[model samples]
Target: MPLHKVIYLSNNAKLYLWKITEDFDALFNQIRLKDSSLARLQTMKSENHKKGFLAVRMLLQHNDYNDFDLYYDAFGKPHIKPQGCSIKDVEISISHSNDFSAIVISEQKVGLDVEQIKEKALKIASRFMDVSHLENLSKEEQIKKATVVWGIKESIFKIKNEKGISFPNHIFEDDFNFEDKKATATLKFNNKEEKFKIQFDSEEDYIFVCAFESIKN
Candidate 1:
């Protein structure tokens, strides 16, 4: 389908979401990929994976940017450098799950992650989050909360984009109600402590997260 949604996190940041309802031919024909991107697409083993990849590029085109304007760094963090010399200082992050793909572009550093709510998140909750926060909730609620916490850490890690950052040990989510739909977290790594302001919401059965560096930093 067309761009599923767009959200403004701040005056300088905007998020776009795409729901994959089309097959590979439909997406592949809509955009032109630079050689590298085309090569990467051909290597994807899953039909869903290839479709998600194309959906991201389709979202880029919706914003008046195209595949040629995007690139990645050594750490595999996606970056945007729009064609021509008119644009600069644009930061981009991309993520996709089973049926949705999302990207966030900002003048400030940002990170994004979208994961479908599933029991697996709860099963591995102790491996990456503070499980005590999951108390006092039904099994269903526990899964939803666990998914948010996982997205919280993943989003923060994307912002840092540094190696050796462990979710359970280095990233901590402050106590907050899942109903709040927003939260704050601290990333303690490299002898420094960094904070993030996070906003999250549900789309269909998936949870999408956006994390920004705390202005107080």
Candidate 2:
């Protein structure tokens, strides 16, 4: 399976998804990794996690970039070296959960998250979201909606990539209709408030969310 799916988050941003159907060795053999990537891969305790890491590299290569071109900052945020004399530095965000790994590359700052839909996200809904939003949905809908909210907050946090941002305390998602397949959130921290635009979709029981910092914020 080359790519599970691709979404154009915007004119300048494209999101890539890889379903981890291949085993670790199958994925590992298809891509090249720098020494640091290899070291980081070795430190992962879970095979699924290792595969996720490898799959991210695969996606990078798919875009003509390799592991050598990727690096991380002190906050563990992933970055891509500006190639040539491009005016805007290319931005990237990576996330994986269970069986899928995802990456989004953009000229604009972007954040991405892929989540496996399960009972756990719903069970902890109260800890991070306004549970009242779940009141009218069926049990199944509740689970999916809760997962989306969590993903929204996660993606926004990735975009901000700063310290002391609390999901429950700082990130707030406005009420949105499921039919809309879109949402907006507000981040209020450090006495500063910012807004973000979010888009999400479900694929094969997994939810993928993308966050872009609002230009006005």
- Candidate lDDT scores, in order, read 0.92, 0.92
Candidate 2 TM-score versus the reference: 0.96
lDDT (tens digit, per residue) of candidate 2 on 1-217: 7988888878999999999899999999999888988998999999989999999999998988899999999999999987767667899999999889999999988889899899998899999999999998998999999999999999999999888999999999998776687999999999999999999988899999999998962
The number of clashing residue pairs in each candidate reads 0, 0
| Model 2, runs deviating above 4 Å | none
| lDDT tens digits, residue span 142-182, model 1 | 99999999999999999898889999999999977888889
The positional error of residue 156 in candidate 1, measured at the CA in angstroms, is 0.9
Estimated TM-score for each candidate? 0.96, 0.96
Worst 10 residues of 1 by lDDT: 82-91
Give per-model CA RMSD.
1.3, 1.2
Q: Lowest-scoring 10 consecutive residues by lDDT in candidate 2?
A: 81-90
